[model samples]
Target: MNFILYSDVNDSSISASLGRPEYSYYFVLKAYHPVLESLGRVHVAASVADVDVLYRQLLAAGEDSVFLSFTPPQKTPVDLQCPTICVVAWEFDSIPDEEWDSDPRQDWTQMLARHGRVITLSSHTANAIRRAMGEAFPVLVLPTPLWESFAAIRQQQLPTPVNPGTTLAIKGCIFDSRTLGLSADALIPVPLTPEEEAVLAAELEAARPPALTLKRRFVIARHYLRLWLLDAGRQQIEPVPRVKFLSNWYWEGVRDLLPDAVHDWLERRLRAICAAQPLPVAEPVPLNLPDTSSVVETRVDGVIYVSVFNPRDGRKNWHQLITAFCWAFRETSDATLVLKLTQNDLALYYSELMTLLAQLTPFACRVVVMHGYLDDAQYARLYQAASFYVNASRCEGLCLPLMEFMCSGKPAIAPDHTAMQDYIDDSVAFVVKSSEEPAIWPQDSRLIYRTLRHRPDWGSLKSAYERSYRMATTQPLDYRRMSEAAIERMQHYCGFSEVQMRLSNFFEPLPKVTDVASATDNASC
Candidate 1:
């Protein structure tokens, strides 16, 4: 059989597509290529049109062919001539079953139905498809074969509860929290006192915007009142009862009296007035973060925990990962968090990360942010440097970084929800607790909440960090046991032989005859 694989991103474009919606498909496709070659000749098409062109050429030559689209179901071509199978990486509990954005394919059921079969990284994704399509839908859960790829790293670097020191080199920039001089006072100005507020209020009352009319002033006042009341209700700020009462009265009695257009116009004007006001503080002093395109090295020691992710991806939930780690080891000096960021645009996450670190000020535990690509040697060094892998993700579509680290024998601090449920457990990881919450499909332009995703409990994650730290410091034997279990789990879960066998069976002459339960041992999604 001739396997024609296609993804929107290729090696030439991967650097620019680092955090794109379907960028991971490139990595997934790369990992699947060698294994697919074992089954048959693999041809990677540059575009969707090329897929059918190649398929026809193979067909004319009297060769059986299949097109594997490494993308989400919504993006897969439904009008293709060749038999197509979408390789989906999904985290939600339900597949999109309704149409939106005037695109029929946005409803995944239509796309998957047209394709007739699907391949996904996790059992969660397969179950979601089955929920939307049917239990009889031919969906194969195929994780990227990765366990065998890290054999050299595993052999050279044995798992340990602590790292003496490891130098991590990257071609971009690195931010070490220890050297950042973080302080909440530097990021946020001090709150005004009641007396000072009274004086400022009088000055503000006398210096209103020149164009402010009585009606407009009332509108602006009402807007501020509503914002303050909402913030108060959310416990984000202190409440002023009089302002809350007035806002509630206006909302209940006056809001309905105004036409929506007028109300919206007033809100817009209010926003403009607010935007013109001076900020409480000037832009927090730039951290003067490293701005370089050359390789830089940093040394990390002690019980080093590492996590790799694109900060732009909301599913990563990196905010809690940092806070939980800092809070868990606020007084400890040995703990270090090495965040290997995959996104290329540093500006996207720089300020937000710095602000978060400042807010959680005075913590002794270190955080090292490496924002750039790592070559094979550097990446292997990173893999070897980790004492444990950390993931505080809200959800995952088969977290490849977490799996790769585990395959290299590093235990983890991760939530056992979504795709991680297949391999993460007490034996191999310090399981962080989570619960389902309503969420929208990532591609749904209408932003309709059609599915559920996990929300990792902050407290559970913090506790996991603390427990894992204690285990690393005091229980070497137990740590080694967990480390061994991590490797064993991956060997069963995504080892090359296991994944290759599953693929061979999936592509058999009478495909769909293979029992998924037996293939996956009823473990993965």
Candidate 2:
């Protein structure tokens, strides 16, 4: 049968050391070539433009396929008379249904339903797709092709020698920010019911200020006041000059200096004061290079992804991560913690963090910071020779770096919250449940007041940190086993065969195609 085999993987020959760009080209070439050779004919395409060219070429030659694989998934494929197959190369699609109300699904179903055949990257996705599409959307599980085409493997280079105690590059970037050339929109205030508001008020009322925290509040207030004054001078604007006390740290310092009973009243007054774009005089300097992931590459004993992407992002912060031990020589004392930080406003907070690290000296000698932007290849080699990775953010969206760690078979530690829980579990990484308070009102590890009267013993936060440290240095780990398991899981759910089978079944029941052009113009709409 004639078919269109499509793949848009950026690098088909992506080395297994690299966790993405599909899993393995060897698997992909093996799966795709056999199908193409056995099929009567196959038109290979990557983009919609390529699709048009291929169709023209086929029509000019008076040839057609009973099947088609739209290279990239989720596009309205140019109307094809033949029952067309559309492939989506994502591991999981969190669609919005009752079960996934926060995700987007109806569009996914519509896109797939329109395509006579739909292919998914993993089994997890296939099941979800079927369930979301009323359990009857014509779909298949063709493993996401690892390689787009073919190539011979190159001799591997020696792993870069990491300076003992030199930090591995640990950076975070928003998933699509750099690629999208965008900054995150400021945090939107979540709505709370009156009952929830009352509870928060009570928590604040019951809370007592941690000692130095008062100084931090004043400092932050001075900060906002400075910005407010700057804008008032330059832009002729005014912002509220008061404070509100709160039990939260994420928005602490500036907001929590006021009494609890009138906190909301103060915030509303502040908003009224600084309604205009409160410019501190200029826009934040844009990062000069691509995000940290752009420079991500696997090293001999380690792999790294970088970028100072998010603060609330728990996935890449500083806590949850594991180490690689394909080699027996790695020692924790010899391991380094390389952190790339820019001194922008949010990153400036890291300056405070540096002071904190110096004061606490927790794991002092082993941690290293490379200030300013760094060389990618330089860091890639550092990562190759390093032991493991970790993040300390309190929240996150899709976590690519942690995935890179797991794909490498290294364990990781993450706060129990965040988007990371979606992929990693007990088998792959450690999830730490922690409270977000210390930075705001100050608290102990057990979600208790640090004072003797309220403080409790060991809590999830402390446990998570301990787990992170342990996994970060775990030697003699089974990188291959971890990597293999991840591969199997991904393949079972997202591999090319899984997608092809689903697509095949989906298209099998569709009316045979005389011509794709005619098919698109008629019947399926």
Candidate 3:
């Protein structure tokens, strides 16, 4: 059988598509390539249109062909001529069963029904589909085959509870909180004097569109006054200003016509009213660094906890990840948290991340932020440098990084929820606690809460950190046992031979037994 594969992202587009919805599908396709080749000749289609073209060529040569779409069911092409199977990675508890935005594909059940067969990265995702599509739905749970890829790293570097000191080199810039001079006060804006406030309000009034009416102007004034009173109340400022309460019914009707300037003014005024604060009128400054591709290095020692994530992705729950790490090891100078950011655009989360770090300041624990691509050597160095892998995500379809580290024999501090349920256990990880919460589908423009995602417990996560650090510092034998268990878990979960056998069985009755033998020599993993 000839296998044709396609994903929205590929090697050429991955850098630009980082943090895009479903961009990780590209990495999934890459991971499956060798395994697919082991079963039959594999061809990666550059575009969706090329899928059918390649399929026809193979068909004309008397070769059976199958198209593997590494994308969500909604994005997969329904018109393809060859047998198509969608490779989905979903973390939500329920799939969208209703249509929205006049797009019928929003209802995943319809798409999966039409596709006939589907492959998901986790049993959680498969169960979600089976729940909507019925238990008979042909959905296979096959995580990306990654265990074999890290064999060299696992062999070259044994897991150690404490790093002697390792220099991690990256092509992008590094930000250390110790060097950042983080100050929560820097995030606050300076209060405006009464005279300055009057001047600014007059300027805003002058800039208002000339068609503005007295009634609309009063509405804006009332809005700001309400805000001022609320701030005063929160700050416990005595002698609050008394303003007549207008019917919110009246305000709601007029709020739509309020100029954008009014909203902007309200934000500025609120920032300027935190009275008696001597802070500058600026938010935390975004990082200024050398070119992203410039080589930078940093050394990490002691008990190091590393986490990789796209900060812009809301499901990452990075706020808790950082804060918990800081609070857990506040007085421990040797504890370090290294965050390897996966997003290309730093501006998206820099200010907020810095502000969060600033709030947890005066702590001896270190926080290091590495932003850029790591070549193979650097990545392996990062892998071996970690004494433990950390993931405080709310949910995960399949956390490839966590699995990768585990495959390299580094244990984790993570939640055994969603996809993690299949592998994480007390034997291998310090399992954090989580609960379900309402969530909307990623593509749902309606923002209706029709699904459920995990909400990781912050206290549980902080406690896990403390416990893991204790294990790393005081219980070397126990840490080693957990490290070995981590590797064993990945080997069973994502090893090449096991994944290949599942894929082969899922796609039974390929052209001939010899066809598989013909491609055996060409398989890389």
What C-alpha lDDT do the candidate models reach, one value each? 0.85, 0.41, 0.85
Q: Candidate 3 — which residues are off by over 4 angstroms?
A: 188-290, 509-525
Model 2: lDDT of residue 299: 20
Candidate 2: 10-residue stretch with minimal lDDT: 147-156
Count steric clashes of candidate 2.
Answer: 61
Q: What is the lDDT of candidate 3?
A: 0.85
TM-score for predicted model 2 compared with the true structure: 0.44
Question: Which 10 successive residues of model 3 have the least lDDT summed?
Answer: 516-525
Tens-digit lDDT track of model 1 for 77-120: 87766778889999999988889868887888888877778898
- Evaluate residue 506 in candidate 3 and report its C-alpha lDDT on the 0 to 100 scale: 84
Per-residue lDDT tens digits of candidate 2, residues 1-525?
556555443243332223222333223434555544543566555554566556555655666554445343333453654446654443222332321223332245555656645655445556656766767555555543322111111012221222233333334332211122221222235689999999999999889666546677677656666765565566434543333212222154543445665666655675543223343677766544434433333222223223233332222334322122101112333433444443323353443443434333223123333433334445344334433345445443334444443333334544433344345555544455544332211111234332111111124434544444444446335433443454444444434465456545544554544554565542252
| Model 3 agreement with the true structure over 47-77: per-residue lDDT tens digits | 9999877866776677877889998988887
Tell me the TM-score of model 3.
0.80
> Model 1, poorest ten-residue lDDT window?
516-525
Candidate 1, superposed: residue stretches over 4 Å from native? 190-289, 510-525
TM-scores for every predicted model? 0.80, 0.44, 0.80
